[model samples]
Target: MKRLRDSWLTFVKKLPRAYSGRPMAFAVLLGLSALNFCSEWPQGIPRPAWIDTYDRILPDSFGSARQLLFDHFQRWFPRVPASQPVIIVAIDDKTLAAAGQWPWPRNRLANLIDAIAAQKPLAIGLDIYMPEADQTSPDKVAGNLPASAAALAAGLRALPSHEAILARSLRAAPSVLGAAASAHATADTSTDLRSAPILVHGTDPLESVLRFDYVLASLPELQAAAHGQAMLNVALEQGTVRRVPLIMGLGNKLVPGMPVEMLRVATASPLVEVFAYPSGVQAVGVADVQVPTQPNGEIWLHFASIRATQNRYVSAVDVMQRKAGAERMRNKLVLVGLTGTGLTDIRATPLGELVPGIEVQAQVIETIFDGRFLQRPAWLKLGESLFIIAFGMLIIWYVPRTDSRLAVFIRAVPKSSAILGIALNLLLLLSCVLVFRYFGLLIDAASIFIIESVVMGSFFSTALLEDEAQKRQDAAREQVRNSGKTGAGKVFDGALARWKRIHRSSK
Candidate 1:
């Protein structure tokens, strides 16, 4: 037992000393790297209060720069030249002017649906919600009539109302109506509504989605007539809509987003399948089309910014008037929504443009069809953490050693370490941008960049302080040697030496 203890003690003594004995510059760099890593450790990890400041600040500050780089890449890259399979029927100023004011009579909208359906489009998604019956309907008009007109009112009320007319159109066509999911819950208002079945193919699907308690659904009459219903609510992060949710959980039921619902209806898929792993939702599949998404069943939309003159928008009036060619509409999914400024449906995108909400959904559908999705895989965080650790250690070891040698060889060379470190960090950032542009991979390197800067700053500061101390020591030694040649000088030197010894002892 004594021999084993002695051997262990000898091995422990041979091990390298702790960080306390290392140069202050290296120690500071090491400490800074650790702090940075802890701040960036995956969101799943529990963190201290101080780390939350970094968590909040880094993303808010760096996210804009990342978005700017993404926009630059988008502008430079050659976009896919194929025809877009999705078309947006925008209710713009022209449409509103031609078809009368906002909320045109439901009977007129019924006629519009019939005209678009004649083009043999795959499906139509109504981004507008009709939560109440048309006020101009015969029933409403009859109720407002006086007794003197009762006989005439009776005949008019007997005719099918405008609500009934629109319902008939919805039943006749492939249509998915929009509903909204709200954060606030109301009383049992959804009792009359029937939610679509959400099937989880794997275990623990509930944890993989964003949950809402209340759904502001379409009118019951419209819901009953539509082929499918979906939530039109967008999920925003920091007030920006960079991603669109494919699925969401409302009460105990999982519901499809508007675009996904339209796709399902067009494909005749009965059930929307949400594939899950222990971590979170892996993908969402409608019929044969499978879409990769983040854990919350949301996709990072690679927005194809359609400018004002981009011909992607077919004015709703043209569609209603049958002025749009059948060749342009055939087999394409149509999204009907308002793009007029009065509607306030505009959303901010990474492209720095405020586009209509329907355009965002249209882009998501386009992304799925083109198989070009922006993804940050589950493994990327781990890979980034390892990268930071490896590079940080290299700087801590390399900088101090190289600074001294470079200083001796050429004084100007030592100053270049800061520039070199910054350049390397910029290169890493550019690589991230390139990977995102060409490969659609998002790797965050902000934390790593910050740590490298700190390391380089520490190196320069430590070198300067050490250099100054060495010059002071050399001057003091020279004065002591000169003092030995004279009596009065020797007395002054003895006093100085005593004071220096006392200072050293005190330290």
Candidate 2:
């Protein structure tokens, strides 16, 4: 075992040690920055999961961390409540208990719409879709009955379909049906399902817009009767709703989101205007409201505080029962969607709240009405990338000089000096919060500082370890030489002593 240990150490000593120099470290930062910048696609195309995973380990300011950073700021400081009256009519536990099971006969839903419309709301948005017919209708229920009930089944079929009833209510009200986008879906054969006309201001952005193969629109009868249709499919990042695409592609057709369509219905705008270039979409205009968005046709969602949200909802049962008065919904955009237990319409928000999907739509409406938006335009992303790269290069140039002046030959940095890096990271995070709070500009400086700091620390740490190894080798060689000289002196002295003894004996 001892021989093996010595042999291993000797073999390792003979091997050459590569330097973790400034240039090598610089390459790491540059690669990380490039990977981050490339991962961004303003056209709403999906990137692979691993790309995001790696960026979390080593980040550029403009990559995955940007959203998380903004989320953190939002958590720390509550946004000012919006003055726009956007109310969500929630179909919660209480409503379900009163309304019986889901897929409730379409007649009940039609009644809900008529009741809300009677309140004279600005617009009515339905967050649910009926891709299939109501199986609970009278004809369908009687079809399964025994043959003896043939007369009963015939009578049931003769009655008006639950679908026609719903269609009538939709036509009477200013209603927008919410549809979901999918890669595999067959849209209903209703041309009325189409979005308002989209007018492009710049080069064609069709190729760059976020795309789905098709949409799961409402039933043909309902679609024909509804005033408008909007895609409820929003852009999700890390299971959270941060940005919402104002417009998205449905196969060859373009559709607006639920909130924007509600605005169109409310304002009676027949056209939606888009400003986009080959790079990406910039802003979307409908009616008199213009909203800034990310390159991918998405606008950042500024959520309302929980306290304020408390007043935004009225029980679905209350609306249906007429217990909640028209004053609650008058002149307001009312969004209707299910939020009951066993329902799948829940969504996560950056505020760390799990809210019904309908609430998300309502917030978007409020954001549009407030006319305050979070803008992280393409140029800002570029600026952030350039700034990080430049700062890293400056540090690469300056760190060594400063370090060398402080230490003899740029020795391993003292542990205490790490405090400065931590401080810098904290300060950057604080600055990002402030910028978002006051200027509505998001800057993820922490990602840049973290990436640079890690590279900087790694370079110095490797140097320190290798320098220690070198010192050990030199000390071992010096000891070996001194021991050999001492042994040689002993041998010479012994030989002289033996010669003197022999000479004295002979005399």
Candidate 3:
């Protein structure tokens, strides 16, 4: 009875820990994922450094391989050309060389507007801003003159004010002035900007569109003169402009973006309509054009790989000098903005090209008009999360179920765990690629792949450590049994061991 009790105790001691470390490791992974997910909500994010390093080294959340695949798909398929009915009145190197530097006298801009207006363009998008009275206006210059030069000051005041000249030019053309959206506490909101009428359908999308605290509108004279005004606020991710908002909110009023305003004026769209589903903002409708957007009212830009502004640009100087013919602007929407190196409006696009900001605005209009979109529904993320959970549980189960001590030592080259991880992710990637090829739906596969790979790797380590512990336990059990053996039993045990060795060798 004593011997039997000792043997039972030894057997119980040799047993492995309950469920090994799988539950612990899996719980920890889940907790970390939960913490990372807080950023998606209103709560603050504890963006851990290790996760960031991993994302950067392999696949960043911002730069999912899906984007690369989608961009290339757009390239290979060639659905629509990047051409639009837009002419960029670029204040480029040539324009600056011909007409001096940026912030040129308002009279010069007025002349440029007059020249463009004479072409009978459908609508002009003036991407420049004149927030304050022109310093170079004749009347203002006159006020700055010394008292001794009273006659010169009086003569200067007699000429028409530069503001009047520009305002009159704006009144002549159906021009949409660009205003800067500001968040600074002291931002200018003295001149009330004309808000785009947003008619909400389902849920109120007042909270969905991008919001700015204040707007730096053009002077009251120019503001009242232009046919329309659009906010020049652009959102960027890591210096790249991949998405653009169609409409935004300034204080309590809704504002149209540069491209949307240009389209609105061109199509004579009286009001912008917002379709808000239970999920979020679905689409923004104006005139006959229906634009699908993300929940936040931004569209994933479908930028085609074409020659950088091959024939899109007409120099500002050319327009001002009448060198660019009226035919260049006839029936076309003209976008005017500075692209001089001194003016900082350059941005990177996914096509690996750095383009002027105005070109991006023009492309937004082109994409909306053409209906070429790369849609990634927000629910797809929920799908990915569900997939990761199910797949991770499978990895946890399979990693240790068939594992054995002997197999651990004689493990196949490129460990079985690694093989499983690669094969499964590759198959998933193939599926995602196919979905993108045919449907134009950009499903993000990188983040899910990273998550599952990390989870499996952790479980793999736990499995190895459990195998090692089990091996040690077996050795201890064998030692206890061998120690209890008497002379005859010990001889029998040695003979059995020799026989086992001979049998193993035979195998």
Give the top-scoring candidate (TM-score). Answer: 2
Q: Which one wins by TM-score: 1 or 3?
A: 1
Ten contiguous residues with the weakest lDDT in model 3 = 38-47
Task: Tell me the number of clashing residue pairs for each predicted model.
Answer: 0, 0, 0
Q: Estimated TM-score per prediction?
A: 0.81, 0.83, 0.80
Sort order, lDDT high to low = 2, 1, 3
lDDT of each: 0.75, 0.79, 0.75
lDDT (Cα, tens digit) per residue for candidate 3, span 220-249: 888888889898777786677777887787
lDDT-best of 2 and 3: 2
User: What stretches of model 3 exceed 4 Å from their correct place?
Assistant: 1-17, 20-29, 32-82, 187-191, 306-308, 396-400, 403-417, 474-507
Which residue ranges in model 2 land beyond 4 Å of their true spot?
A: 1-20, 41-66, 136-158, 186-192, 402-416, 484-507
Q: Write the per-residue lDDT of candidate 1 for residues 108-180, one digit (tens) a residue.
A: 9889889888998889999987767789999999999999998999998899999899999999999888877
Candidate 1 overall lDDT versus native: 0.75
Candidate 3 clashing pairs? none
